[model samples]
Target chain A: MPKQMSRHSTVLKSPRRQAGKPRPHSGEPTHGPLTAEELQLAVRNHSMPLEALRKDTTPPGLHYVLTHFDIPFIDTDHWHLQIGGAVQRSLELSFRALLRAPSITIPVTLECAGNGRSLLRPRPLSQPWVLEAVGTAVWTGVPLAYLLTQAGVEDDAVEVLFSGVDTGVQGGVRQQFARSLPIEEALRPDVVLAYRMNGAELPPQHGYPLRLVVPGWYGMASVKWLSSIKVLTRPYDGFQQAVAYRYQEDADDAGTPVTWMKVRSLMVPPGVPDFFSRSRILPPGPVLLTGRAWSGQGAVQRVDVGIDGKWAPAHLEHPPAPFAWCAWSMPWVADPGEHEVSCRATDASGAVQPLEPVWNYQGMGNNVVQRIKVTVGQ
Target chain B: MPKQMSRHSTVLKSPRRQAGKPRPHSGEPTHGPLTAEELQLAVRNHSMPLEALRKDTTPPGLHYVLTHFDIPFIDTDHWHLQIGGAVQRSLELSFRALLRAPSITIPVTLECAGNGRSLLRPRPLSQPWVLEAVGTAVWTGVPLAYLLTQAGVEDDAVEVLFSGVDTGVQGGVRQQFARSLPIEEALRPDVVLAYRMNGAELPPQHGYPLRLVVPGWYGMASVKWLSSIKVLTRPYDGFQQAVAYRYQEDADDAGTPVTWMKVRSLMVPPGVPDFFSRSRILPPGPVLLTGRAWSGQGAVQRVDVGIDGKWAPAHLEHPPAPFAWCAWSMPWVADPGEHEVSCRATDASGAVQPLEPVWNYQGMGNNVVQRIKVTVGQ
Candidate 1:
């Protein structure tokens, strides 16, 4: 997620509030500038509900959606992906051509780097996000590496830039949503220019016609509504690349750019009451604890549950797909009283989640441990 | 934490089980090899209770304790720290003399590298630790850097090894418990040869006479029962250094050694019921979500709460100290229903807690997101 820009006062006025203007995209209620009330409603309605997250596969309608502005209006009949800049051949490939290309399908979890930004103290004052900025889906598309090869990337190319059709004023500058990755990362076999999500043609909210799927990276790197691919000899200094998605230590430091999704795990809510509520009560008995754990760096090796404060081993179910999260559970004998429960996961790369997050200006990768409280009664 | 070795058959018989044998450490019932019954009692009595974690400062008695072997009996009156190996001057400084040296006090959280080991799959078959292997204390000690400088470290010195008096057979090898750190890390300002913990002389279970506190690194790197410091021109290949504290990717790769504490967070149970129990039932009302967030890399910038997958910004409290965790809370309006709640934290360095932990052979640094379940009723 890019750092939100200064709000343009003129654009804050919703099109609906201006007059009897029809919504920008027919059939898509969430496609135009939203009134304050509509914005809140949109956030509530568009978020991937916890109920939907309990299943192994995320249904398309339940997919988490995050966009900087309105979803771009794209006509599939006229859409084309332009490949230029440090490439020997500049080519414009229509949607049909992309569909005809050899395609591969892989499951990947795309998380917004700014997923927890709204929770930060002295908050960023923009994009008040909660954790619903993440989702996993099976994406089917041609490898971007293959497309780059077809365009014949020049020898001096150092970075690959992806630009989307969505444009707005951010950080006091008008620009398209653009980001760049090192050539090495951009050329990974799993990097794709996707047109299908979860076996269906891309939904309008998910960048219909085309989008970049830079697996393992934060969603910002996977530019939605991707329109152009540019091979660059120098690192791209576009707004998103140089300023917005960067993790700055302070005003003085040249920040590190957000990249791969950190290792994380989330449990499917066991049938229970609001965990943070004071009125939570329960009857002591045996209970099963379960959740899903995954990592962008490698496979999950183990997951342990900390019941109260005692740690116990958990049983891990094999992942459905290579990059999918592993399901884990542990049975606990509950005693009547208040209890705090939490779990930790270790990954193949030896990286474990931290008890706390490393703070950055952008609030990019907050993967801190999660805890919940519950009450029990006879 | 080093891997456990084959147990000596002769030592398996607990003195208590042998009948009428006096306890090894008078007044401390937890000393020596424990009988099955004693093991259960010790686990019940000695583990840090979760309620104690709710405060800003952890009381010494409430601090968590973990050890690989019996606590060594060290006479503070006769104890001395031996500094030798690749140093120009070899010196043995008595406890009093060491205390006379310049001392600084700093708060540091020490977490056992194997703190969550038992939680891993294929259970480690060793110390089955559940999460109570971590605590924070204010340590006062002369800087190890000062002593190393006085000892005149050799130009070629590459590593500094710390040896502890507590020793038993581990990994089938009989040797003193020892670990080494790179010269650069050893020379850090926070590395200390400590004689005090929380303003008092170190406790018996906490390496009483002397210990090394390597803040920021896992507790394993901070050798307890400190006896000697050895500077080495070559990398130290002690059992703990070469074979145990390392995180192996697979049987084929030379695993990376565990180092700094990863980012993580945990909430103090907010007066609730046993979360995992099936019989949990509650009356809906407002609930307060609260917890402490900290990081070894930097300060925590944010902590967000996820209520049934819907996210909300949390209000954060000022940290009591720079190294201490920042307190945070979110007011939640509970609706009658089953719900799961969780939280994530971001640090000043931009590192976020992972939803899951990266897996490793050593099961070190498992920092995964945590969740709990509860039921609300009318």
Candidate 2:
């Protein structure tokens, strides 16, 4: 019999462990490293563990979890791309043709459409993403602008449409999902129709053959399993346009509709109330307080790190590459005491993270200040 | 040691026997049906088996193959959604709240970005799809527009963003994926942020808790594992925008650089040439000419079926559900001579399938008329 299989990487270790009693903080005047049980307890409660305290950047393996149905595999040899609509001529190309075009790679950040949903007062009806819905990638492919130019997009062209190859049956309903974009963004020089990620060909798990990579926008803009591109005079109201990426204003306990939300950011590490107690021991002195920052509008201009409500100058790492998270660090002089750490960021477009809480029905674009507590002791 | 597991369904029959070769026309033409040996050969070569002559709608199990990657599973309790960006407030929600929202259901078709790719000459680098990348389903979810209205979109808001909780590495690049829509489309009534597919909650294979159900477009925009949404003043310029979705003009080979492709449709099934030559004993009597039709623009207004290059009208199912392939059927009136059949479609937007070929870098937007053949008896 042909084999049936489930494939997951062997390199990574599962973070989930057997359940135990939740750890309660003891207000004792002592300094020592936390026990393994204490670390597991903290994580179970959605709090950062001690190892998470060691680095500002959350390791990819330990990042939060979010998944839908099973991942699908797509063969690339026979893949094709079709471009039609408000253009002088329509075209269809092969995967090899797409790769031969002028290639550009951009480092971009993709945040989940519902990041930080776990933090909501009344949990939303979705995966409980414990703040791990973000990542950086170098996408390489031909620019959409280059293609549209070749097609001779008409002056009246308004929107660009995108589609992918994945299919599934939800209940009994069959779906041919798709989304569209404005011609303006479709013609942007940096907008890429990527076939490669990092330095390698796209993995089947990702969109192989071709996928749309629109920077500075949510990941939805980057369609996977891409097949067709249509230039439209007006707009097409597909389910995604009319339904998916939206939010509600009123804090209705029932949940709001999906629409766009406000700009927001998150502190990478030293999570809110990071420290468990004054008795917890910390690493050696002169520690590096590193974290990640990003903005929906443009590049992050600056990030501020504060300890115990006092602002400290932060060492901002110019984005390692464009369209990526900006790494920032602060050198802290450790002393045995209770410490509350926080970070905030400002974007080049003059947008800054909010210090107070903001509420939306869908829990979108939430860039509230990130806070973590730490106890420095020998 | 951890026990190894297999995901194969016990309820289903063995796939091995199902994967067989099509039969050759012979005898009274109706007996044991196509042997297993013949069926396998037909599928491998992207050819139709003769057994298709007996039925109207393709059996569910025999549906064409198209996929982006492996199926994924995500823990629901820990999943959450985050919404923020260009709004009055940022919010975070858990999976629970999303399910509690007022939900609506609608039928839509979701096709792979690469359906009919095998029709492209000179082979592309991806899967060789034979026009089965599409499916229809009744999706239930809250209108994203409703959510956006609740978000109290700011005056400058131009684009709405969507993010997913799903994650994977492509070409060594780690990305947290998301997509977006224009404000106009975002407010459309037809769009839905779906959580339940058909009558039941979405299966894990199909975005479990929620996914964007953008009708009339392609599949990628319906980002699964939704986590966040954002509103922006200007359009996004992420890698997916500039490089992946775009296609090249006049480049037919797989090596060409193309960003986006044109809008096109194919006549699946009845009109597909060489419809089914794999069976040895073909079904006798009136042959049912049946197929599916769809377009990237909107609803398919009409589908025409042709036998032996002679045009004949086919009846399209009523209420032609949006984003879903419309099923059509017609009597073949089998004669004693060899005959060829074909089918074509026109969408509500006045876009019709082309008889001639169009060229593009990625070979997307095929929409060429599909042809099938049948040899009648002595």
Candidate 2 TM-score versus the reference: 0.42
Q: Across residues B1-378, which tens digit of lDDT does each residue of candidate 1 receive?
A: 112211111112222123342211112212133222222212211333333456565555445555555455578887889999999999899988997999989888776666554445533333334444556788899999999999999999999999998755454445678999899888888788888887877866677788888877778888999989999999987767766665554333345667766566666544333211212334588877677666666667888788887777688887765655677888888788778877878776676766655555556666665565656766
- lDDT per residue (tens digit) for residues B249-366 in model 2: 3222112112111234344332121101210112346767666666656466787777777786788785445455666778766766666667877766566766754433344455
lDDT of 1 at B344: 79
Q: What is the C-alpha lDDT profile of model 1 across A188-281, one tens digit per residue?
A: 8988888998887786667778999887677888899988999999989776776566565543344566676667776543334321121223
| Worst lDDT 10-window in candidate 1 chain A | A1-10
Compute each candidate's TM-score over C-alphas.
Answer: 0.45, 0.42
Q: Residues A41-160, candidate 2: write the lDDT tens digits.
A: 121112122222233333222222222222234566776798999999898988878878898878766666566543555433333334435656777899999988988898899999
**C-alpha DockQ of every model:** 0.01, 0.01
Residue B158, candidate 1: how far off, in angstroms? Answer: 87
lDDT of 2 at A76: 64
lDDT score, residue B164, model 2? 70
RMSD for all candidates, in order, please.
Answer: 27.2, 28.8
